[model samples]
Target: MSIPLALQNEKFANCQESIKILYLVDDNFRCMCDDYNITKENVEFFKQKTEEDFQCRMEYETLSIELEEEILRYIAERTDQ
Candidate 1:
């Protein structure tokens, strides 16, 4: 007995869908690995670096505001002189 053409096409379509699903999963895994630094000498290295970078940025913004205030004060003082 021979399989019907419609049944064979349906099977092929199912296989293609399965392949597409696998590709999607593989892509998602690669994206996650890239985001988290999948390979490292130390497991905490990326986390530590991210935290340190955040702290440095916060400190920099605070200092920048302070510097701007000081500059404005200096300009006002010189204008009054």
Candidate 2:
């Protein structure tokens, strides 16, 4: 898989890269579903997955700008906390 564009740009390295940092969340979704014997009717797993995929793609599309904005926002947010 390709990395975000903001990561590719050296100019925005300090600001963007720092904010673009995402910790890969451990999703045991498949294991959970199997363990629980989940049924589609009881869970909207597929829908949630589709939504996440779309959001990720959108993020990837505007990686540079979004990452820069996110980094700035994160820095500002840190001050408030």
**If scored against the real structure, what TM-score would every candidate get?**
0.46, 0.28
For every model shown, the clashing-pair count is 0, 0
Instruction: Residues 1-81, candidate 2: write the lDDT tens digits.
Output: 223332345564666533333312223533443344345433567788889999999888889788899999999989974
Residue 52 of candidate 1: its Cα lDDT?
97
Error of 2 at 27 (Å): 34
Which regions of candidate 1 are displaced past 4 Å? 1-43
**Clashing residue pairs, backbone N/CA/C < 3 A, model 2:** none
| Predicted model with the maximum lDDT | 1
Best by TM-score: 1
lDDT of 1 by residue, 1-81 (tens): 222233234445756555445445676643543444434324567789899999999999999999999999999999984
TM accuracy, model 1? 0.46
Q: What is the lDDT for 58 in model 1?
A: 100
